[model samples]
Target: MHSLNDLLESFHLYAECERCQRSMQLSVEKLIARLGNDFPVTDLRPRLRCTGCNIRGQDLRIVFVGPPGKRMVFQYRR
Candidate 1:
């Protein structure tokens, strides 16, 4: 498995609020800008917050959206 830093650096993160089900996409640059370069990846959950519902990071579902694999297209439909 990739390390948190590796995942964050190479992929976009999808954060969803558990309470409101609102979601947002975060880039590595934005995360670094918000949390700083020294922030620990394991500690990210406590630092996230839902903009719509004001939910805490601990209550959010965070998914890593990585690059497309072989035989996969760039577009995502769901």
Candidate 2:
């Protein structure tokens, strides 16, 4: 069986922000706390019921651009 250490060394998981277009340090932190691992994390596509306060419109556009990279627009209208 592959030990955790060996597996970890082989492939690492990382997360990128779908917003600020950067490494989602904040979200990654939270995900790590909940999942227990944060190496091979996925991009964020956070969605929730329409904010009673209507913070955003029906949907939102989540963008991710880290390290002077291009933007990843996530136009979420849900």
Candidate 3:
């Protein structure tokens, strides 16, 4: 099980709306400040709401963005 604290360093968290397919990057620092560092990352799914469609369910994506100056590429398929 991964906590929010584990993601703070190298990983980037994103919330994607299942309905409208809207996606947004989340601030891990702000989240840790609010939800505490020990919060389970899996439990975050139900707590998220889509800003675009006002939906209650969200798909969480934990991406490895790597260190500075590293090349990163993301691919999405519908």
Stretches of candidate 2 exceeding 4 Å from the true structure:
1-7, 24-78
TM-score of 3: 0.84
Q: What Cα-based lDDT does every candidate model obtain?
A: 0.57, 0.31, 0.84
Order of the predicted models by lDDT, top scorer first: 3, 1, 2
TM-score of predicted structure 1 = 0.58
Q: What lDDT tens digits, residue by residue, belong to model 1 across residues 50-75?
A: 88877677343334444446232233
Model 2 Cα shift for residue 17 (angstroms): 0.7
Candidate 3 residues lying further than 4 Å off, grouped into runs, are 67-78
Per-residue C-alpha lDDT of model 3 across residues 3-55, encoded as one tens digit per residue: 99997877788999888999999999999999999999988888999999888
Q: Give the number of colliding residue pairs in candidate 1.
A: 0
Assess the local accuracy of residue 64 in candidate 1 as a C-alpha lDDT between 0 and 100.
Answer: 41
Note the residue pairs that clash in candidate 3. none
